[model samples]
Target: MSDIGPESAAGKRTLRRALLATRNGLTADDVRESAVALAARTLALPEVAGARTVAAYVSVGAEPGTLALLDALRARGVRVLLPALLPDNDLDWGEYAGEGSLARVRHGGRTALSEPAGERLGPDAVTGADVVLLPGLAVDGRGLRLGRGGGSYDRVLARLERAGTRPALLVLLYDGEVVAHVPGEPHDRPVDAVVTPSGTRRFR
Candidate 1:
């Protein structure tokens, strides 16, 4: 395990190194297709069978097959939620329509292009969700996840844990990024499973 938070230069350097290592192995289009395919397979699993409402992250680098999976879920009458970042850097869950429904919504330094049906909800709203798909630069066999340096998911997942509800934590990563371990700290949140282009695997 390693010390966490953006305050530490060392942690940031390690994260940067890991990200470069991961990205060096993944081409843009390769990751996009893989993300979509793996997402499709993960959603088909029995764990997501009864999930009428689910929450997923918005990917920055390569658009993961998140939209495709959301559309499929919507066709099946599943309600989907995406993150709407608050001023305090916390996450607020919101409804997400397909890509066509997107509109620009701005925060401090980031602008979110969100779906039309987007409705904001507190962290508590996430507990009722059956599945929560997270994005990561890298994830390890022990379930440790390396996020994009922003602590949004960390804070939100921690809040969920405090409420005693365990949502299925799923990560989408490039196949080669999966490893034996990732540097982690007390504030770092781990995923239950990881899905890559190769396949979906439970982290133990």
Candidate 2:
């Protein structure tokens, strides 16, 4: 195993502090607006624009922002899917048309907005996707992603890799969540892009 020591604890604390500071400095309205703007910028990316379908995760806890982005994607006539976490913490994709279109659903400690009519793509869904906006707990300059202590995304993305897919996996975060380096396990995944409040950066 990696160090998993005080540095890790300290890094997590720094991340928490950063999130708190961001929240404290910005009102709810500001965060919402910034999220919308950032979403718009993401859609402008060639990878995002060309994607026929995209899967994104619903924001939970103190995660930066995503609601407005979901709405923006829907407004643009894009097919958007949110993760439906299964009992084993495996993920299934479901369409999201907005809060109204979503039915209340939760599993594996993860809350989900589900669309019964939404098509459930196979594990190959990752390979078929034109772009994927990944969710993570933290990210670094090299695009390494630290998920919520779960190996789900890594496993899924690994499936895509074996099948030889090039879907752009992009990590979304708040402004300062992008760090110089972060502790990464061997199974941790790296994203192709990172989208922040200010802009979208191509790292892969």
Query: lDDT values of the candidates?
Result: 0.73, 0.71
Worst 10 residues of 1 by lDDT: 110-119
Residues forming the 10-long window of minimal summed lDDT in candidate 2: 108-117
Local error of candidate 1 at residue 145 (angstroms)? 0.5
lDDT of 2 by residue, 1-204 (tens): 333667775665676566556656767776677678777788788877777777786665456677777777778888887766655657777677777765566554554534334566644565666778887756777777766555678777887789887788988877777777777555556788888878877776
TM-score of 2: 0.80
Q: What ranges in model 2 sit over 4 Å off?
A: 1-26, 108-119
lDDT of 2 at 6: 71
Model 1 TM-score, all chains together? 0.84
Error of 2 at 177 (Å): 0.2
Give candidates' CA RMSD values in order.
Answer: 3.0, 3.5
Candidate 1 per-residue lDDT, tens place, 167-196, comes to 788887767778766767777777898888
Tell me the lDDT of model 2 at 78: 81
